[model samples]
Target: MASLPQALPEQRAVGPVTRPAPPPIARVRRRRRPSGEPPPLPRQLRASGKWWLGLSAAVLLACVAVVATDTIRYVDVADTRVLQAIAGIRSPGLTAVADAAGMLAAAAVLHVIWLTDLVLLAVFRRWRHLLVWLGVGLLVINVGAAMATTLQRPRPFEVQVLGDWSGFAMPSLPVTVLAALLVSTLYSLVPPGRMRTIGKWLVCGLLVVTAASRLYLAQDHPTGVLAGIVLGVATPLAAFRLLTPNAAHPVRYTRSRPAHLDVSGERGAAIVRALQDQLGLVATDVAPFGLAGSGGSTPLKITVKAAGPQDDGGSCVFGKLYAATHVRSDRWYKLGRTLLYGRLEDEKPFSTVRRLVQYEDYVLRVFCDGGLPVPQPLGIVEITPEREYLLVTEFIAGAQEAGEAEIDDAVIDQGLAVVRRMWEIGMAHRDIKPANLLVRNGTLYLIDSAFAEVRPSPWRQAVDLANMMLVLALRTDAERVYRRARRHFSDEEIAEAFAATRGLTIPSQLRRMLRQQGRGLQDEFLALLPFRLPPVRIQRWTWRRGGLTVVTLAAATLAGYVSVGLLRSPL
Candidate 1:
């Protein structure tokens, strides 16, 4: 029930006279309220908690009252016929399946799954989901066991037990434990799409089968099973609605699925299909490579490579889609960077995805021709009128991050070589983070050149070297990295580098990481290079351009009007 993302209105202007479109009114988010009041509790929890609390209390009271008054018989009316129907439908095959399901629903299985889930959630830092799981498990076990003993309800069968049955069976503990764990685990961890849907249906089928087995095996009455299911489902559902992560976040790991024969699973299926047609090859699978999102703009991934005719895509290619909205944001972000860094983010007219795509393609061509290790840009594909453009490039499979590899002199040489090669061609990669540099089969490869340019600005070049220094220092000792870098660069060059990157901005998390690792990469670089670079002109539309022209016109017009008024006064 989100209230945002209202659709654009369809109305149009009637008059011939037209006006320039208005700039978007900025929505100023107040970080703190003027009243300095704590945020109000959500109605979801307040109202639902009251209702659930009352219902749970009433149910408990009713259970106790029924036990005390010996009115449990009234609720057991359907137990006899339900048991009869279940027992009559039994067969060897059905019995075998029931036995397997009974084992699956056993308390031991639930315990193991719960432990595994906790380990996973802990790794993901999904603390809220873990809390929900722990709370629900505790309630179901203690409360269900207490009800069973207090009610003193008998097993449906009088014969010697075919399997281990615990205590009285007023509320089936097995059903309660299994269903609660399955539902909560699935709901909390599953992402949106077909995978989630299939998981839900599969869990539901298992629940139905397990519930029937309880009745057929004469382990509990239908009422007991029904009670277990109600408590199990209701508790987890209510808890998780209030507990799951409230925001999208980046995970520490990436998961790759085995490409299926069809591309239906992919969100960019239409774009994939078009690529398939263009290549004249059947695309058996698609792997989405969206930059794990929310905190930053994400790039889309389209690859039918896995399930292609070969082990890899028949063609050695991968695809990226830049959505229109992201393009608009890039324009503003590039402008901000230009102001702060005094470097051109992109050519004039603003940073559109189309413009970036073209720039990237041209840059990649330059690298390919110059014998640099970079991905070959294939072509560009347009997917929509809103500027959803796709860039195709050669795939470099199983590339390792620089941080993951050994940070010895050899690795340092590879990094230096890449930067020095770019410098030879008067090029600079403004962003030289650990993620952007990759190593494959002992060779370093550079990817994500969307922010690169052929500008040979001294400061910009120095930023690349300084950023690399910071990145490598995190992996190894500062002195070792510095000594290795000295072999490739002189003291003066190193000094200029640190000087050039005086105002570099890095991601907050990365900054904290460098701090925790016993050294400041940038500080160390600055300490080595005491001198700064001289002023150099960079292409940008400053106030000196548009603003200066407008100001001059206004001044001239004012002077002319004043002169005319003086002449009239004299007359």
Candidate 2:
């Protein structure tokens, strides 16, 4: 090859020596449109998108402020006793506990967002949708605080609260904040599917514990806590609607069979549009279920039978819808205030919905797994995006008539068996009743375990029994029911167990109240609070069934009491 001749500077300049061929002309590919299809609208052009972005940003900013402000004021006056006790016993341990709890909360929040975004992006592969949810969660905490403060709500502490406390009373800030975090986290992390059903129950249980912890610790009032949950959950959900895909046509179901679709991953608005479009096939003639009871706790059952070719009426699946009403103030909105008093949402006592849904789910699942008779738990479903309605498993065959007739001798026996089984496993069906103990195919099946306290002590165990007796008393003559229950044991034995487990007698006032119904039940239950108070649990221990020590803790004491009472009673 001939040696390359050196090019003169002039020649090189002429040939564009310093420059190169213009960057390759890039081509943008346009998505091909199907014939007759309308042109796709830009995502940002939708009105809902604007609202979604705005609402989500507002919620996120609020949450950050609440967390930061609360974190800065680290004193929790309500838990002084518990804290002092722990610190006195183990200095390092107390410090570690405090540090760990704070770390855990922070980690949990971050992890929730991360996992939420990961799942949403992975499933839908949409960045914008993920952003909307992240924003909604971030805003929920601070919004909860602002609302709580605006309301001038008070914490449940009987003594002086530690920090700058100010808020209206209604929705609880702590409970609501927890609810917001949990709902948003679950909504983001888990896709609505077979697995989601279990996850939802677990999450519900977790939230209940959180709320109860707050109440038990005397951090916030029950009403305030519940209010917090409402605000925390509702705000994000409303924002989610704004972020819906079809801005003009949000997801809505009225007298229509809900269609199962991939509503997970996308912004709330998108999910709404998808639901509306997919479930449009449902007949408008079918009347949907409505909300029932105070606090919007009770769910209405909706049965859909197939009338068309696709309909096989005999094999139709039943759906339940839990409805929600707007409350003025909610608990989760005042999270910062509650936390200042050493209150965490999970510590509060279980709510009606909490019992119906969370405890019911756990009881059913655990009993079912233990080979006990239970209604088939098809799974819990969300009727709306708002996290208000929760559907539990309803029996498909042979609906029984409602009334005192529902509580017959056979039903009572079954209830005893069920309670006995629970007791044997070191569990207490805290709210045992004729309604909760359903009769199916002549077999008595336990239904609601909402307040069931598993692995309870003698006191807790007795109170659980007392609650059952109380319920039984409502349906039948108290003396007669007491006599019949004595057949399994003696009156004295029952009383002893009752005393040992619950620590006191049912007040005459409460007894008279039970006869009145409704408010009576509420008052009676509340009155029994002194006896059934959840003990100040210093420690919690989990043990295997086979462990001897566990067996001793679970059964020995209760068994000894029952055995001694039986021996003392006359035949």
Candidate 3:
């Protein structure tokens, strides 16, 4: 072997094998711009400026009028007769006239704004704007009344036989009108900016000037004028911001659900059969899961099946039946046909729950149209006047009710993302407890819209957000849980939500028991610490600005505070 190596086998020269270069990438062709098309305008700039201009002009006119009137008040030369006449006009008679004039003027302006809003809605099909306008009008009325009560500034000195005068003197009617007009006018004309700095400044300045002019004109005292402006200014701003842009508020319940009698001698079995037949539910084949709830309440059975005929006789789909006995004064067996065909909610008046379900049905449809992930509603059927209500829906298989501990950090992260999407769409769950939130095959699903209201009250929205926070807080750090919620909601909103659920009952007694144990827990925690920041520290940190996330988290914190207190307690 060594001798052969020494001979050095003629080294086979290896040539560098060359591969052909990849074919030149096909060039991406640039899309040609459409011929002669103008660039699109920014939405903010496209908003009409006419209202702003008109408001500016009106303010100038009012200023001029005030100055001219003041000059007249001081410069008039008066003999005894002239003085007497001037005094007569300035007396209660003239005061009454001026007051009436102010009211009439306010009414006229309000009517004009209303008509303009209606016309705009009709032409541009912007109902949201119309709602804003209506809300503004309501706020103005409230402010005006409050101003009159707060400021008792009196009229100019005058004497008249049988004269009549009333209302506060400081903020002159003209000045109040000017302030309201400017605010409302600007709101109507200006488009919403991400920050709205210019509009905010404009409103602030208008209020200041209106108050100053009224005092200078001697129509109202400085205090009265200031009070009126303050009142007026506060309302519109609070209402405008609180209303939430583009929120579609459903009609409030005007009347209670009517209590109708059960149909005479209706049998529970017969009604169930009739409904099954009508809805084409094959109740005979499937095994049903039965549950008995609070007494005088219904017994529910969940049954699964497929819709159409199957050769193999195996179906994966299911339906739920809610049946309850309807009791009369005589304690007769008039099987209550009242059945909840759909999901349930936290403790609520039955009537309210029904309304909520109806609203949710419509809202879910809306969400579907808008491309949001929501459970598809098949249909709802009422079985009887007093016995049962049934809802047919796509049963999410392998879905599990989220438990307190199971809904940990990961679940919360995913759930909050869904929450953000809901807020962006101007919607809230109105009920965010674990029961309503489902995890099916590892995907979080929002269910149980029986208490769902589209664009609910601020309190309601907060409660909904808090409910979710409570769910997360049960298994996670309170601080971190709230921080996550604030990424979508504000502190004030959170506080409000907590306030709403103050007296509400939880579905689980364990939760209630923990809450009961946690009374004065915040104080106890404070006492235990050597030093402590304010309880609202989390709120301040999260929602000091109007950030959506902050507001959302604020809600969550309140929920978390309550939830964690319950969870950590020695049960």
What are the runs in model 3 whose C-alpha is more than 4 Å off?
1-276, 285-304, 307-360, 363-374, 385-387, 425-428, 490-501, 505-510, 513-571
Provide the lowest-lDDT 10-residue window in model 3: 333-342
User: What's every prediction's RMSD, in angstroms?
Assistant: 23.5, 31.4, 25.3
lDDT, each prediction: 0.60, 0.43, 0.43
lDDT of 2 by residue, 292-387 (tens): 111223333333323445534422222333322211112222222233222111223334333345555777677666545555554554333343
Candidate order by decreasing TM-score: 1, 2, 3
- What digit string (tens of lDDT, one per residue) describes model 3 on residues 1-571? 0111111223211122122221111112223325563212101212223344344345434434544566323322222233344444464555555444443224355455445655654465333444565555555554454444453334644423222234655344444544555555455445555335587686676556534333222344443454345544444444444342211111111231111212222333433354354445443333332121122222223242343454234333333333231122102111111111111121223333234334556776766554444556655445532334445454555666554335655567666655655655667665566555667545666665544556544544545555666666555545555555455544544454454443342345326534755643223322323333332211221222334345556866874574334223210
Candidate 1 lDDT tens digits, 130-171: 656766766677788788888888877533234557777778
Better model by TM-score, 2 or 3?
2
Ranking by lDDT: 1, 2, 3
Clashing pairs in 1: 495-529
Stretches of candidate 1 exceeding 4 Å from the true structure:
1-267, 290-316, 341-352, 503-512, 516-518, 528-571
TM-score of 2: 0.36
